[model samples]
Target chain A: MTREGINQLVEEHVPKLVETITTHIETLTAPQRLKEAMLYSINAGGKRIRPLLLIATAGSYGSVTNAAYKLGAAVEMVHTYSLIHDDLPSMDDDDIRRGKLTNHKVYGEAMAILAGDALLTESFSLITDISEQDLAPRDALFLSSRLSEASGALGMVGGQVDDLAAENCSLTLDELESIHRRKTGALLAFAVEAGGLVGTSPKEDLTHLRKFAEEIGVAFQIKDDILDVEGDESAIGKPIGSDVDNKKSTYPSLLSITEAKRKLRNHIEAAENALKSLSVPAPALFSVLSYIELRDR
Target chain B: MTREGINQLVEEHVPKLVETITTHIETLTAPQRLKEAMLYSINAGGKRIRPLLLIATAGSYGSVTNAAYKLGAAVEMVHTYSLIHDDLPSMDDDDIRRGKLTNHKVYGEAMAILAGDALLTESFSLITDISEQDLAPRDALFLSSRLSEASGALGMVGGQVDDLAAENCSLTLDELESIHRRKTGALLAFAVEAGGLVGTSPKEDLTHLRKFAEEIGVAFQIKDDILDVEGDESAIGKPIGSDVDNKKSTYPSLLSITEAKRKLRNHIEAAENALKSLSVPAPALFSVLSYIELRDR
Candidate 1:
């Protein structure tokens, strides 16, 4: 698939993936208002990077079963859940996310927390539903384990704690790398590797795919930090410079923009090189790499 | 085992179960404060009811193994995490829980939220660890599904949202039942059912255990409502009449105190009957029923 073809596939699948999520959550016996609150944020939609990557990676290897879309949506839900909780007054305390009101802003704090909790819980249930049909239970268990690990304290939650602790404190480039690697890199890498896991990719291919994911994942966060300094505000959507306002140490803050871009380029190059190690052409996967390199600028 | 024997078993096992939780959480690569927040709350130690019930239930069926203790600790972690979040300023906002400062009070709100998130994620991972050891993958998946359902939107979280929503509103008996049935009942029921799930109890036995759980689970909540109105404040520990102060509806408020006791008695009778249906003697499980009835009087 060409770059346009890959983008087209992503575009086509994201809505269906969201619909899959809405449909599953609808079956929950929760209150109507709680369901509405959950759906409100989910329906807002965002980059859809995680789901699209999982699908595209699986597609590249001819293992894009129908189950892939649901899994992709599940990953997105987990991401959204983290964002909702992260935006609470107690956490990041952001008023806006992705250019709209944060969950607590529209739904109130209690609902926002519950909505996030509901989403996280339902993400796992969605996997089980798929396993009941297309995927094996053991395979679903594998995905669940990976998802939990990447999002757990040792991963994104840990990074958030570190990030919060480092606020207003100058961080070395290594400290910056360490925090972002857990905070952002874990889930992004999981998105790629989840596709491999679901597709039952060979061990060698899985390792290469994971390397590709780690490199690009770090690159993606660095790009966000770089964009906070240099990218067009409208193109990026949400407010930038909040990091600066909060005195958060970022890529551009720790290293010169030129040096940060150098790091980003290195990660992107590493990602591209890792992709080449895969036996298959993986055109869609390559498109993913290019998209990350080009995003926000 | 006699009731004293069961009491001795609980006394013997609670420390081991809590130790298991502490050891597992100590291994997390999260920031120090987050781990501290988690341990502080887990160390506070409530009744150890959930894990003890799980172990006791499994034990009665001759399926209690060392792995069961770890699984019990995981359930306790989930319970502890919920309490941490529930006591947040955004939620219940209580200062003290289990006779200590709540997680947010001790670790600050940010670490508290992250700690709760970490505990929730680790709970599932802990189960997966047990599955990797003694359980079949499918069996672990089954347990995970049940746990997520009981704690998810349709379960505890949903109940909490409803409880929050109904704060200023009047509630019917059915409405109050709906709330607590989801809020407190689900996790309690899950403790009993989880033991059966991991033990591979026969379908008929599972049904009886579930019935027993549901009856006693609701009974437990009704007893809480009763204690709030009439039990000794010092023994109950937390300040009482906060429910009435909050003007929240309760069993005694909705139905008279006498009627509430009548309802409790009926449920307890039903629970006792359900226990007899299990093919196993379930002496420890019976003692659990007696303990709930006797506590906080």
Candidate 2:
């Protein structure tokens, strides 16, 4: 598929993915305020990159199943919940996210916490609810287990803890990479691998997909750092140089901007190589890689 | 089995349950601090009532399986996560829990939040980790789905949201019951029902166990209210009259003390009737009911 074709595919499916996510949340028999708080964040705009990656990878192997869409929604919900909690007064203490008031700002801290909790819990339930016809119980169990491993202490949460600890102190490049690998890479890897599993892709293809995701994950973060240093403030949503202002280390801080760009290119090339190793063409995944390399926000 | 025999059974199994729970947490390759925060809360003294209830129910039907122990651990982890979040400064703001500093007080708010998040995510993972030989994938999926329903937006979290909103306002008895039923009753019901499922008990018996759990759950909360009004501060591990001070509605406040006691007795009787309806003798469940009725703390 051409880049334009992949872009069109993303545009068409993003809305459907959002609908899938919202329908799940809407069908919940929870309190009105809680649902409102949850939907408020869900409706908040995002690029739906993670879900798209999952679907695209699944598409690379075969048809993207309905279970893939549900899994996509599940991953997005986990991402949103992490953001909600990270924006709390005691955490990042951010007032705005996605150009709107953060969850705690709108719902109050207590409600925001519960909203995050509910989202995290429901993500697993969402997985289990997928029909056996769409995805077998054994596969569902594998997906659920992998999701938790990617999001829990051994993955995103652990990385977040380390990131917080690293603030106000410089970290070695290896340490920095270690944090980002778990913090951001783990879930992205899960998204790609899950798509493979859902599509029943060969084990070797799944391994290559994981490597592709890992490279892109780091490349994506490095690109964000580079953009923070050079991109337009308006294009990025949040203010630029906030990392510098906060005295935190980033790719540009530890390495020169030119060197960080070089590293980013290296990762992108590595990702492309992983895609090349796949038995099937992955034009959508390649498109995603290009987008990550060039995206401003 | 006699009440004394049931008590002996509980005494022997509680330590084994703790060991199983601790082993799971210990095996996680998360950050040291994250693991410490999680273990600290897990080791903090509680009656381990939820896991015990699950195990006892399973035993009532047949010999308990290793999967039952793991499931019990998963439920306890969810319970522990809830308590950790509940004790946060922005939530209940309690500085202490189980006579020790709250997780936030010790680990700080950010780590406390992450720890809770890890616990919640891992609880589902734990279910998936259960061997298929011990518990079939279908049954594991069912348990995971039920757990999330009991603990997510529709259940414990929803009830908590309502409970927080009800503070400083009068609530009807029905409203009060509704809140407790979700906030506390849902997970309790899950523990009993899950035991039956794991033990491969008859579907009819599972229904009775759920009814038994539902009755005891409300009775448990009502008894908590009564204890708050009359029990020793050191024994309960907190000062009495906190609900009154917080202006939160409770059974003793909504109804007179005499009326509340009567209601508690009625629920206990209903719980006993539920156990009696089960095909298998449930002396262990009866012992638990008796404990709930008479315990000071």
Candidate 3:
């Protein structure tokens, strides 16, 4: 798939995934407050990168339908939950996300918190309920574990912790990489690997796909740092220079733009190379990975 | 087991369960904010009814030191997460839980939200990791589904929503029961059913146990309503008539005190009768169900 093709594919998948998520979430009972909070943040648009990754990864192997759809939706649920809690007044305290009011602002902090909790818990239930034909017990368990690690203290939560701790403080390049690797990279890695696990991607190929995801994960964050410094706030739909305003260090702050761009190119190249090792054609994955560093919004 | 013996057994289990819950929560990432929020609310005291039901149910059939321990701890995690989210500014907005600061007040709303999310997600992972010896795949799945039902919208979340919607409004008795059944009864039912699911309890016996749990669950909430109205404030640890102050209707408010006591006794009898059909000597469950309405505080 070419870059334009990948974008079209992602666009097509985004609404379908959103619809599936909404339908599934509507099944949840009383916590309409929490569900509303989840729906608010989830409907706030992002690139739909995580769900796209899951679907694209599934497509890379064989097909992306039925059970694969549930898995894709589950990953997005996890991603959305993280973003909701992350934007809380006690955390990043952001007022806007994806050009919309933060969950707390719209739903109130309690509902926002409960909604995040509900989404997180509901994601596990979603993954575990894939029709028997889609995946087996052990595989479901494996995918659940991957999702857990990605979202748990060892992964995104850990990264958030490090990020918060590092606020108003300088850090070595390696430390920054370590932080993003767990926070952002871990979930991205899970997105790719969960696809592999569900699709029964070969062991060696899984390893390669994971490496590809890891590189792009860090590169994606670096690009985010660059965009935060130089991109249009109206286009990005979030405050530019907020990180700098908060005195938080970023790739652009630590490395010159030229150096950061060079590093991003290196990672993107590495991601492309990793795709070559996949047992099946992965043009879509490669295309998406390439755009991560170059997209303006 | 007599009623006194059941109380003594529960008394013995409380510290161990609290310790386990504390230890498990402490393992949450060292993000001081998140950990502080989790620890603050979790350390607060409660009845530990869910854990007790789980352990007692498990003990009724066989030894489940390892299997029941984790399930007990996991249930507490879910319960605690619900409480933390419930007390958020957007919800009940309570300052104190069990005589200490609530999670949001202590850790800020953001961290409290994230911490609750973490605990909720981690609960499933904790349950799924139960050794295969203790719970087969089918049983594990069953337990997961049960827990999900108990905690999800049809259960706790549903009740919470009704409670929120009815805040400062008069509630009919049927509406009150509907809320309490989902809010408190669902988990209690799960507590007993989960215990039986993990044990060698007959299918029929499990059904009866669920009935028993449901009765006691409603009865338990009624007792709480009564206590909130007439019990000593210091003994209850919550201000007397706060529910009335909030304009939330309770059984004591909806029914005359004498009529409310009659309702409570009726539920207690129903709970005991469910167990009467069970041939197995589930002494602990029997005593607990039998004496549910008579307990003070």
lDDT by residue (tens digit), candidate 2, B1-297: 345754786786788888888888888988999999999999987767888888988888788888889999999999999999998888889887667889999999999999999999989988998999999999999999999999999999999999989989999999999999999999988999888888788877767887899899999999999998998888878778889999989999999899999999999999999989999887777877888888777
Worst 10 residues of 2 chain A by lDDT: A1-10
Q: Local error of candidate 2 at B40, Å?
A: 1.1
Estimate the TM-score for candidate 3: 0.93
Error of 1 at A231 (Å): 2.3
- Model 3: DockQ score: 0.45
lDDT of 2 by residue, A132-225 (tens): 9999999999999999999999899999899889889999999999999888889888999888989888877877888898899899889988
Predicted candidate 3 versus true structure: per-residue lDDT over A1-297, tens digit per residue: 457966777776777888888988887655566667677787888887777777788778877766677888888888888888888787888999778889888877766766776677677778767776777776676677668768876678768877887889999999999899888888888888877777667877978887888888988899999899899988899989898899988888899888988998898889888888888987778767756866787
Worst 10 residues of 1 chain B by lDDT: B1-10
lDDT of 3 by residue, B1-297 (tens): 356866786776777877777776677554666666666766777767788888888888877666787788889888988988888887898887666777777777656666776677667767777778777766676677678778876678767877888988888889889999988888888888888877778877867887888888989998988888788766656667888788889998899888999999898888878878886777887666654565555
Ranking by TM-score: 2, 1, 3
Model 1's alpha-carbon lDDT is 0.84
Better of 2 and 3 by lDDT: 2
Candidate achieving the largest TM-score? 2
Q: Regarding TM-score, does 1 or 2 come out ahead?
A: 2
TM-score of 1: 0.97
TM-score of chain B of each: 0.95, 0.97, 0.93
For model 2, the docking class works out as high
Q: Give lDDT per model, in order.
A: 0.84, 0.89, 0.79
